[model samples]
Target chain A: MSDLSPVPASAVVRVDLPQQPYSIAIAAGLLDRLSVQFQDVGLTGKQVLLVSNPVVFKHYGDRAIAALEAANCKVTTAILPAGERYKTLRSVSKLYDVALKARLERSAVFLALGGGVIGDMTGFAAATWLRGVRVVQVPTSLLAMVDAAIGGKTGVNHPRGKNLIGAFHQPSAVAIDPDVLRTLPAREWRAGMAEVIKYGIIWDRELFERLEAAERLDRLRDVDADLLHHILTHSCRAKAEVVAKDEREGGLRAILNYGHTIGHAVESLTGYRSVNHGEAVAIGMVAAGRLAVKLELWNAEDCDRQTRSIEKAGLPTHIPLALDPDEILAALQADKKVKAGKVRFILPQHIGAVTIADSVPRDRLREVILGAMGNG
Target chain B: MSDLSPVPASAVVRVDLPQQPYSIAIAAGLLDRLSVQFQDVGLTGKQVLLVSNPVVFKHYGDRAIAALEAANCKVTTAILPAGERYKTLRSVSKLYDVALKARLERSAVFLALGGGVIGDMTGFAAATWLRGVRVVQVPTSLLAMVDAAIGGKTGVNHPRGKNLIGAFHQPSAVAIDPDVLRTLPAREWRAGMAEVIKYGIIWDRELFERLEAAERLDRLRDVDADLLHHILTHSCRAKAEVVAKDEREGGLRAILNYGHTIGHAVESLTGYRSVNHGEAVAIGMVAAGRLAVKLELWNAEDCDRQTRSIEKAGLPTHIPLALDPDEILAALQADKKVKAGKVRFILPQHIGAVTIADSVPRDRLREVILGAMGNG
Candidate 1:
């Protein structure tokens, strides 16, 4: 790991969509300076609805409220239940009630102040409330700050599949306070590292080397603050660049889903209980790496390096033994990316390179699942 | 009215949104030629989920199916209950189930084949199903052909208000077969004229003069096919031009809500049973006309002419006596346009001009409502 240094005052990454352009502010203590950050982005003296889960609100709600109030903004709060299970249209309906009760106008902003679940639900609510409104994402978890918070993909889950219902609603701004990560659960912290490793494999070779060099990544305290800041900045820049090229996921953005196709199947088959998103992605990446090598899309050496990087981040690189391979295959067929019953895989070509493969044979997919489970 | 002339082979009005631009195809017997239309829009040989209401499906489902199958497209169907009351998130959830059961892919097309309710729900389903898919709107009712199906505004109603939940998803193509209007109910036909009158008062003076020249607009037979075609073309063109200028309702598009502010209130206060959308819009237009005259925004003569034009369409020009004025005021406050509890209204400046008014005194709003009810 690199030597310790002060985290920069703040870094700005812009999401340059022609219709709704916004910036993300990454800093160490942004929550305390949120009023100025919002003001800098032209959000001031407005009615702001701050949405958070009970767990997140208990930790950071007061600071959020005080900051907005300090900027002469009228603040209203809606505390939702915590959990991925609570990310639903029903939960979003509750937010509408809050906005309506508060008489939030079109100009009012919705601030999501939690992890990915809260960010997704709040963003969907903001998108549908009065057709659309401004949303400012205050992502507290590493997964959200690095992935969910950077993109405009906002939605709730259906019993049939994850994010089966949502809108591509860009936020007015994204505020990431790395200090909030101190309270994130250990499992979630490790889970987020999987995505960071994903960016390294698919877009940034240097980031991949950095992960390889780090001695410890299992916990927040294991890594120095400067290293953490670099990870966040590099990962966000990779995402921002990809999103800028394809705001609606027409083409290039699909690479960001290198492991998500299989990862989603694993998550669904486990009922989203056995493995969290980051953990599932970690496992999916290992399978995808093997698939790439077998298909000759990438050499075996690069694939092995990819697997080692995932391991270095304290994430699992194998499928759970309890989940059936057949069920995973069925879930894959039902995935959103399956066009005409054919699954599309985002396979890596080498470090910092990937390609979308729409013609993966079903037998290969089945074999990979079973192989990853150690039953091949 | 002008002499009866053959309805042009087809009238195509393009909604020129830079991100997702599409065309509205207005033609006679277009349902039989659905295959060709879908191909013209680059949506051929795809898996299609056709959504319609039981009432509408009973009328045109077989023909629509035959046409798509002729194009070599695989088709599935889901029929929903017909009515504004059924336009809810629960109804949309039913669509998600249908899409999942059919294993509809991201590249699949969701075709909405009914009036406003069916189109809104289906478009929303397409928007959220797998984050988004291609949606081709087949509008059956006159209200849909001219207004609801043209703009990308797709949503369902909330218990609190109408269209309180939705996304702005532009259709890949809007196929309007005017022949289907032959089976439309008399009330719905009359209801559609209210929106036609709205376009006249807001943007097109020639349309206003044409409506005044027509002897009657009570039913499909009352107006010749030529005049009806002209009405659809002009109204749709007006909408397309306005939407092209402002796709997101930022500023120029608010003028499109000329009579909708008070119209929504009347619909909500009446529980959406006593009056349909177009009828409420008719009454709201009369009230807006009166308010415009009283505010000296337009002369009383012009306002009277506007009322006469609405009356010529065989629609009501006054709020129902049973609906209380105070409740109307309360509903107005709850309208999506209400910013900080102040109601913003689109008031007519002249026959072909309007301006958004955000500072109307409360007493004047009340007086206009009472005066339009014949109780001033």
Candidate 2:
């Protein structure tokens, strides 16, 4: 981690989808320069609806509105309730009301301003409102900036399952301001590292090694600016490259769901109360690593190395002791990715490489999950 | 008008979207061959959810289920209430429940078997189910068979407006069985002719002449079987060709909204109660024709010809007396096609062609709408 060279002023990663190509701009202090950025992306002189939650709005909503207005764009605001529980069709319905009240037209722009929940709901609103309009993502959390915001996978959860209802409506642009991390809660900042670590294990080896070289990975305040910039830019670039090749998750894009299979199961099993997304993904990655080792897809040394990285980021490396492994397995079977009645897993072959394996024996899955629980 | 000899075994109109190319099959007795057709489209041996309203299901559900089962596909049925009012997110939530209960995976197929309402809701469900799944539209109503079923536009109505929530998710296949029309209500069957007339006025002059040649265009039983098949095939082919050239309604496809600009407003102002979709579109086409004639964009002779054609089809050519002209204008301003505060209208240039006009003077619009109400 000794490379202390100054990062670029703003790193741009292009998501090259033929239908609606867009770019993610990673930079420091982008909120103030949002008007310029949006103008650069062809969003000026348009009707823009800025959607955010109360918490996020209190921090940055004014800046976003001012930026858009300064860009000569008409701006309207819809503030939704905060939390994962609020990410529902009901909430999205409220956004539609605001859009209609504001008279948002087909060419209007809906700017999502907040974390994954806000971005997902706003993007979905934009996707469905008037059968789909343009949406620009302004992710205010590390979790969203690196992962959720970059991809156009926008949706709200159903009572029965997570992301059971959604549309693959890509955003016109994704503008990330790293300065927002300073205000993000410590838990959310750590939750984001889980995804950054995920990029390392599945796609980028140098990123994996850098996390290992870092002295501390507990909070945003502890991480240097240069490393944070690199983490944000590299992770966005990796996700962009994968999504560009397979925009609809037809084949190559499923690799991005490396930890999400078990991770989503864990989140659902816990009723989304105990573990945040990043924490659940961290725990899922640990179990996936163990499963990879048990299936002889990867070595124990690589598994242990992955576990240490997860722990270093202050993320949970195991499932909660109270949760039943069988229930989790049931949830896994019901996951969207389950095909032909078989649960598919993206298992690591080594650092920075993984393979999608649906052939993992059911008995081995039970063993690895139970082992991750520290009991059998 | 005499070209239709036997109307091929099944006329196939390919919607050539590069990302997800699909076909719309128009046939006379295709309902009995549903299983074979679905299998031919790569839907065999998979989990299929057949969504239909109780009314349509009462007549066709058993056959569809039997056919799918015969093809060795696992089939689940979700019977919703029959009405445009029932097309809401809540109804879609019921479908999500059915999908989850059926354990529908990412590869599961959702087959819509009803009118436009059922097809729209079902397709919307398919679009959002696990981010997106394969959908086969089995349109029973003539309106759906000709217009709604051919386009990939799927949506549900919001309290604020009609079709305010939707996604552009193309179907894997659209199987139109003309035999089902025998059971369609007289009102719905007539409503569909408005769209057929629209295709004529916008792109097909021969089709317009064919309608003029028909003796009676009021009811399905009154129309000859050969002409009915031609209407279904020709209309589907026209829509497919337009959607193929512009899948997203970016430029060339806006012309498809010929009567929809004012038609949708009339539907919304009526609370979607007083007028069925085709009736409102019929009225809007009358008003649009008048507007075009008043603006000198189209001659009065062509406009009167269009009115006579709509009248011949048993469609209302005048706006409902109870609807306020101002309210209709306001609703038109709120339409999805309104760009930059201007309501874009697809005005006719002649019998078989139209042009997009956003510069229609407001006073002239008011005069034409009032004239259509027989008050000017």
Candidate 3:
């Protein structure tokens, strides 16, 4: 948005919560040099609760600890097990124990390090410990730093569904260093990219074009870091502006769920193991677009353009049998966004704009599912 | 603050979290009459996840199920084991499993219809489920309705320490009916009364005098419903107002920990079973008073009055030898509130006013402990 110039490391994307307004920082390696950053945010050397798992602890814990220590700030660690099931009340227990062992005061800071799973569980832990703690996220994975880390949405998963248990506890500051993704596996990297691309379809088509042109553009070998940074900053700003206006997903915020309703059902039915979050969302996005087209909100061209982009990024674009359209429809019955059991949508009319509506009829919904499956 | 009117079949204390605040309604006959009151809060028919243990569920679950059904709301049940240990990830798993079976959506609510343990664990489960869902507490215990139910705080205890895992998740509405306490044991009733009496001494001398005049305020039997409602409202208002201003407890909220610093250490040293929260606070308050006097921050007369009041409430006014003061201090060193490892105190200068200062010296802290044990 600012002519692709590298912004200051302190450049922040704010999510306005009058009770606790927060900012998200996206830079190449902010975590390695984070001591000074904490000061600008009014966060003095208070105790910080660092929640992560074994793998992430080994990779980034020591560096985080050193950074805090450099600033003369105290930090403690709670390394939980990795995976989705571990993102439950039980895992929160272990985190609580560690904080208790550290004697975390109500004013202590809770930092989440690692992937979406770690951030989710740790954020939920912070959301509840002593009613709540000031949470700061140091996301180590691309999927986490770009998507999960930016939103104040934090929670553990109920076995019934992914992120079935959670809170809207926003972070005080998010120290995101995209360089952390250098060590991530190709799959995880791609999963995060799916979300990055999502920003293009939902709010800014220029982002989509840039992402589509990356392969032919200058940066090579790995994903273009500059391109990545630009996308990250813009996407974060987009969500931040909306979140600032709609702290809770009550109105404008719901449009950000461009691909999450059916995506959540897919994740739940598969128990979050069969598909990575982005892949499920990729499929869900396609399905939602088809539904929009069926309802005459958008034409087939919009559907094809979006699905092709997801496919080009190596993301899935079709719903699987793991979830039946009927079941997803049923799950929608209880969505927090539903007013009187009607499913809501954040569907695109074209590449440049999206619509938030609940006008899709039942028969049209069925036809959309069938069309999305290319089945009838 | 309002004139007594036969308790109105219930007493509702509104804890305003204007940013995301919900109300707490403490009443009688809530189990049979929740449907009507819930409608007053913008709540209509929706799925309800009733979380409780087998014992309480057997007695009240059927009635809950019947009530929700009459209102045409879908209902599901998740039963955890009846103990503190079950307040782990394992227990939350049961809730998740049931919620999944019922296909709970974001609008779904979890009803915690039991005592403190159930209320805490269930509240946490709701807080994390789907990142957050509405929690409607129907506290059935005197301890819960008077203390746990009144606060928006919800969490589970960790094996390492009590309330190590939790969230400041306010229930969308707390349906508190004092009639539920009829089943509580005498010991249970007495435990809850300690907190009731505590409000009078630390903040309201008038409430203290009233409790002192009661023949069995500690036992909590036949303790005039209106007086109890008055006591409950005063304490809740104090807590709710603090929470409204500082939901995350940054600075001004620290005074709420008047006796918690040392009391927490004592509880940790003795494995939490040694004392209930109110019991610990009773002694901690006295200890804090003496320390305040020793530091010349509080007058001796005020400390004497506070001590005598605590003693008269049938609460412990002395620290126990079950733990060494050194070990207690070590644990205090880990408190999230401690800065550079020095413990702080909320010392009262007089009734109705207190100061949160960390000027207490370590040698003085040790001496205060010695005096609390009658060694001075």
Candidate 4:
């Protein structure tokens, strides 16, 4: 995969918002070639609001801004602090202030040039300012290029809840430049691989099998820009297809939240500071897999394959910090998915297949969470 | 329009959210029949957090609570003070505290049971609580039923800006019973008529003609159940259809804020204490129309028709008391629709036509505004 012999572009993932159908261009040099996606979306170089954070600015933000500017897109930049904790109304106020200060027109496109936090906050600001505007996703990180950039879940987290305030605002185009990931920290790179592996486990077992075979991920690593692009293209297409069918997370979209239930709680428990989102979700995937196995939805071998790939990719597949079962359970009760006081868990029926089970008994859930933590 | 004999079984205008198709039930008994909309939107006889204020509660709170309870919806009512000054983040925080205290779950729906102030505050709370849940719009005043209820534009005003902190969160369902307007004061009802007249001038000339012909809104004023439902049905459908097609308000939605450009500034200048939302927007409509004639987009006769309709509705179509044009213009600069440092105004092309023009010269705009204030 790392042999950069001019990789053939795979199918572009189309998020079919019939009202505003857009393609996610997931490949290396795609950011530099953003005009293609914009052309496909029927938009020309207009005023663009480029949103990124300081860390991402230090990495790929300049490249992104330059690329759009090169494409004749009028661009202005605002760099925010990087972190999930910063995904707040107050934090997003920085971007709103910039847009206001820059005198951005209603038709101006908001180009998100960082990770999921930046993307979510930027998309939301775009959604509300002057009622709404166009958003273009130029995701830099592996996690953002695939998961965050593809779906249109734009929001800011409340002090009491993750993504407590949000809107389902779709982007006009997504420019996923995998080349930017070369500068990513090793931990974040590995963490992002967890979501890459997640796409395979939840939808395409073939992809998972390929990942399992690639024990040493350097072949699949960000250093190899073309190979990295291929990975993002595949992952983004899978996510985009799902989002297309259900833009508002009514049905198929929930499948995408496979490991996020427990993952969200873990991040919240640790104040979203200790572990990356993907790493926390990696642990969540393992826990959900265990629950599925206990419920006879999957066999031991399938679970073992998950374990190997997760660990091999250098991602955690177990819970941490001896958290109280009651606290986790309480958070579960407070979960946005909790309906009728019942916890909703997305469990794997088998590798590449999942279901939203809303009736899982609390005691049984507590056992699965405790068992997963003990395994660590 | 008042001589209606047999009204349909339901006058409700339903918004078909593919996954959750909820209704804007416009029957006289809708406030009493809240369960129908709730159940249709997948909100069963679940817990309801009713957010209202003392003014509404002192009048109809007990009956509203009883009506909801009779339907087996576990109702927890939070009565706040009735004042525009109370529409703040601090108020929203209090609302969140109330929802937290009631332990609102995902299935639970918040019933906004008062006027615009209550609806805005409660809807903002619903938009942010536990990352959002179902919000049932039971707007009591004429302003809310026609303007705010169906739009799904919910938020709390920031000190620095109005509606700066908000989200486009659609209510699970809107239960608009025009019966509630019977108890509303004439001043409040006239304020709502401004929106009604504005909508007519923009969308339906026939509606405009009807208002122009009505010497006294006896049909509307007497609160004749059948006639009132007919009136609300058209209003709700007009707003809902616009919203459904453009949920986030990219372009077509801008038409709905026809008079709000200057209207909002008028409110801000007065500290929200003197001018009501509808009255301010009414005056703003006159101001915008004057600019329209100046820009040669609208005729003087069309302006007279609109101004006369507003006056007949018992609404203010002229700028009120001692407001300096420069101060108002500064406030207008801070208007949410001021993009690229230019205020985007929705001006009428003719009596029945509206176009969003962002290129109005500032000096010319200030001239029209000052002239309307009788101090140019």
Tens-digit lDDT track of model 2 for B1-376: 2455555446778888887888887776677688878788888888999999888999999888888888888999999998888889999989999999989998899999999999999999998999989899999999999988877999999887888899998998888888899999998888999999999999998888889899878898888777887787789888988999999899989988888888898888878887999998998899898889888999999888888888888888877788898998888788878877787899999888999997778899889888877421
Q: Among these predicted structures, which one has the highest lDDT?
A: 1
- Superposition TM-score, candidate 3 onto the true structure: 0.85
As for TM-score, the candidate ahead, 1 or 4, is 1
Cα lDDT tens digits, model 1, A1-376, are 2344443546788888776778888888899888987888788899999999888899999999999999999999999998777888899989988887887888899999999999999999998887889899999999999999888999998886888888888888999999999999999999899999999999999988888889988899988777787899899999999999999898999999988988998888777787999998989899998988888899999899888877777889888888888988888888887766778999999799999998998787778888999421
Candidate 4: give the clashing pairs.
none
Q: Which stretches of candidate 2 lie over 4 Å from their true place?
A: A1-9, A374-376, B1-9, B374-376
Give the range where candidate 3 chain A is weakest over 10 consecutive residues by summed lDDT: A216-225
Report fnat, model 4. 0.39
| Candidate 4 local lDDT, B115-151, one digit each (tens) | 8888887887776565567788888998899888777
Taking the tens digit of each residue's C-alpha lDDT, what string does model 3 give over B1-376?
A: 3464544545556677665677777656667777875677655688888888788788788887787677667778777787555666567667777776777777788888888888988887777766677888887776677667655677765666567667777777777666666677665676666566556545666776676566656555667676667766666666666667776566766777788888777766777666767677777788888889998989998778776656655677778865677787777776556755667888887777788878688888889887776320
Task: List pairs with backbone clashes in candidate 2.
Answer: none
Ranking by TM-score: 2, 1, 4, 3
Poorest lDDT segment (10 consecutive residues) of candidate 3 chain B: B1-10
* Chain B of candidate 1 vs. true chain B, TM: 0.97
Residue runs of model 4 more than 4 Å from their true location after superposition: A1-11, A35-43, A218-230, A374-376, B1-23, B27-30, B36-42, B78-103, B124-132, B158-161, B164-172, B203-255, B292-302, B312-314, B327-366
> Ranking by lDDT, best first?
1, 2, 4, 3
How do these models rank on DockQ, best leading? 2, 1, 3, 4
